[model samples]
Structures are given as C-alpha cells and as structure tokens.
Target: MNEYLTSLDRPIEAVRYAGLTVKLLSTGDGTEVIHHTLQEGSRWSMQPQEGWTASESIFITSGSLKVTVDEETKVLSTGDVVSASPIKQGLVFLALEETEFIYISSQPVFQFFSEIVRKNQELAIEVALKDGYTAEHCKRIMQMSMLIGERMELSPGDMCTLNYASYLHDVGKIMIPKSILLKEGPLSEEEWEEMKRHCTYGKELLEATDSPYMRASGTIVEQHHERFDGKGYPNGLQRDEISPLAYIVSVVDAFDAMTTDRPYRKAMSVENAIEELNENAGTMFHPEVVKIFIDLIPEWSKMKQGV
Candidate 1:
C-alpha cells in the first residue's frame, strides 16, 4: 500500500536555520526537495554530518551566491546549478544578493536544524548575558510573550515572530560598550542615548538574515523599545505606529527585566513588578498586553513556586 498526504495534512512550514530560510517542498520516497532563501551578505557554514551520504544538487532560482569549497570560491548566478552534498569539509556559502534556490537530495534529510537553531539561540543568549543581564531574563520574556500572544489571539505568523523577537529583543546589547552596558548606576544622558542604539543594531543583525521570520523579528526588535505614548527611542513611534508584536514584547520584556536581577539593582518583588507594569502600562506599553500579562502574573508565580 502506498501512503500519501494532502497539503493540508503536510503543510509547508518554513524553517530558519542559521542564515538560511528552508522549506521542505517534498519529502519521503528516499528523496527531499527543499526551497531556500539567503539574503545578501549572509553566510552559511555547514559541516558534514558523520557517515552522511545524502547527495544533493542545488539549483539557483534567482539572485546570486558565492560557494567556497576547500578555499576555492565560485559564484553561482540565477539559473546556475551545482552538485554539493553531505556538506563537504570547509564548505561555505555567501549570498551575493537575495538568493533563492532549490535543493534536490537523493536521501531524505532534516533533524540537524534543531541542533543548529538551538546553538544559535544559546550563542545569542550568551552574548546577551555577557553584558550582565540575568541568564533567564530573555527566556522568561519569550515565554510570557508567547502566552500573551496566545491570549490576545495573535495569528500564527505573528506568534512565530513574537517568539523570535522576544527572545532576541536585547540582542543589540552586544554592540553597546561594556562600560555602559555593565554600569552599576543609571546611565547619563549621553550614555542613555548611546544605549538606545541597541534597538537599531539588533534590527540590522537579524534583518540581514533575510528569513521571513527573522525579518519580521527584526522589525519587532527595532520597535520593542518604543513607548506607546510617543516617548520611546530610535523613533517616537506611538500607539498604532508600533508593531503589535513589539508591544507584546515590550510589556513582557519590561516585566522580566523588572523581576530579574541586574548589574545595577536587585530583582523587584513580584508585587512591586506587578505594580510597576501597571503604573506604566499606558505610557510604556500597550494597555491590553499589560493587562493580559498582569493577569498571568499570579499564575506564573504559582508555577515558579510549583504550587
């Protein structure tokens, strides 16, 4: 008996791994067809999987890319084709433009993406932690952001964007000077201005990947610092000018930061965190998101205490 599934049963889900956006177009039958997109200047470095024998051919659909194998670089333009499988040693690709391609493999593949995304997220967290943010700050923000998104009934795409944006909202801190990022006291006016540049830096970093999820995430990251009352940084985007996902993240991010230890101060009590969030809801965050998160606080505290 032959088994087949409809598109509804096997929907196409895009996966952003490292710098490449991948979609499994077809699978099984001992073969795999993947659609990929890489933005200009993005680099993808893949090491060979042990004992892997998946031989795949890459066909460029549009734009251009430079493939380097064993230190020899070759540029592939639109309509170009190349056979490179099992990801040979020292194989790397740099997108010269917004490149798209199709990869047909003689063997079914995947699974490696989980590890790749995990490691990348860990690296991002490590980079953020180096600046004195709590280890679990981003993780908490991401969890609450997802829950708030669900409560607000966000669309599937918006939920995905929220996940990435909330987790990486502070990733631009990597660009801030250690002196400013790690200061024990409040930032001076000039230093505060410099600190605000992180929003722009984060957007640039993630937007360069060109993946749909990351690009949307970049927009959210850029606006996550924006206040609802037009008092935010980088831009004074107010009210509806802000991305809804960013508003969700802003509430969650502020709550997490308030409730977590920092280089300059100790963590606030749960009661104080709640009060702070409520106090600034209209000015610093979206009223609805803040309300949703505030409602979730007691439930979250119970979970934390294993009650």
Candidate 2:
C-alpha cells in the first residue's frame, strides 16, 4: 500500500526552498525542519545573503547539493548538513534525479534581520544629527567644508572625501559614556579626557565595520582633535604635519560646536563664531582653512535654511 499522510496528521506544511516546492514539518522559535524534493535537472542559485540575526542549516536527505560560500565551493551528498550564520548569504546548486533535504532556521529570523538593518540605518542618521546638533547645522558645516576644499583646488574625489569626512567627523561619539556626554556642568579633567577619546574611538568603530568610505575617515578622526599650533591631544603633531583632510574637519567641527547650543552653553552668534575662528587662525586653525570657511558662511546659511 502506498503511504501518504495528511498535512495535519504529519505536521508537514508546504513551503518553497531555493525555488523548489518543499514541506516544512514543524517550526518553533529559532528552529524549523523542512523537507524538499528536487527534480532532475533542477538548479539552484544562491547569493551572499544572510539573515539579520539567526543561523541556517540545510541537511541533504537524498541526492546531493553544491554549495558555494564566498569563493569556496563544495558538494554535499545525502545526509550532509550545511551550517552558517544567519547573515551569511550563500549559493546552492542542486544535483540528482530526486533530491531531498531538511532545512532549519530561526522563527523570527526575517523580522530580526529587518529590525537590525532598520536600527543600524537610524543609528547612522542619529550619529549625523548628534554631530551637528540640528539638520541645519550639518548643512552649514558641510557647505563650508566643501568651499574650503574647493578653494584648495582639490580633485573631485578629494572634495567628495572632504564632504564625507565632515559628515561623520563625530561618528566616534557613539561610543562615548552617556554620563559624560550629557552632563550639563563643566566636565572634570577626566571627563574632558574621555570626550577627546571619541576621535580615536570613532576611528576604531568605523574600521571594525564593512564601510569602504572609512579609510579616509579614519585619518580625519585621528586629526580632527589636532590643533593648528600643535596643542592637540592623542597626538600633538603640529603645523603641516596634520593632514589636510584633518584640518578641514577640525575647522568645521569647531565651528559647529561653538555655533550650536550645547548642554553647558548657549550657541555663539554666527558672526561671533566666525570672528572667533578668524582670531584663532594660525594659532588654533589653519589660516587658509579659516579664510575659505569665512567666504562660504553665507552660502552655507542658505543650505541650512532648507535643512
């Protein structure tokens, strides 16, 4: 007698596995069992896709499968299981007259992945906002930085580099201790030291991620704290020793900090902030950077209005 079971009786539900119809026998939180049967000549194409935050396993029940992860490719025979992190997207090709396999995965895997990517994007936005305080502030600083980079006759690529550098100048502050960052009173010397560490901290954070734009950003972070006359922390290298990109970031960063309201002080007027930067030229900021920055303030304000 042929043996066939009803879905309710066997707990096997229908599903699609790598474009093939399959049956999912059961599913629970972070775990599921699926059975798939493949026809002869059926093929599977896998991409480097990983779930946001779960693990996946595919076990061959009959026939075989060809799997490729990164640049490494392998073939798995019947009863063979492949395991990988949920975030890893791999390639799979099917082989055999009738192939069967059990695939397992986390229950909320897709939800978890979506949530993480959403939050990570938000974090990127938040980091940008926190650096400039307001959208307008970021706009003004970016315009000003771009103007200075342009005046220097930098290549289009360098100008793009400068813009991104200014945008993420404070990306390291994500690692700052909240107590110190949010404090309203004058920071103790130790707290001040902690604040300075954001530059180093930001570089390290960017490097740890998969961002390709972070290479130049790493230098900006390292030099954003450096003073024109050389009394900077983490590294005191003075004068032309500081990178040009670092100089641009330093000028933009200081301008935004002074002209924007913070917990400890009211914002200085734009005019006063500009004057202050001019006064510190050659002493605290690169004189050339200060000059170009001053020229861009009006145009920067126009962009700020939109933000």
Candidates in order, TM-scores: namely: 0.59, 0.56
Sequence-dependent TM-score of model 2: 0.56
For model 2, how does the per-residue alpha-carbon lDDT over 112-179 read when each residue is reduced to its tens digit? Answer: 22232233334445544334354345445555776677588664445545654665566566677777
> Which pairs, if any, clash in model 2?
30-107, 48-89, 49-89, 50-87, 50-88, 51-86, 172-202
* Number of colliding residue pairs in model 1: 0
> Relative to the unseen true structure, what is the C-alpha lDDT of residue 28 in candidate 2, on a scale of 0 to 100?
57
lDDT for model 2: 0.63
- Give the whole-model CA lDDT for all candidates, comma-separated: 0.71, 0.63
Q: Where does model 1 exceed 4 Å of error?
A: 1-132, 302-307
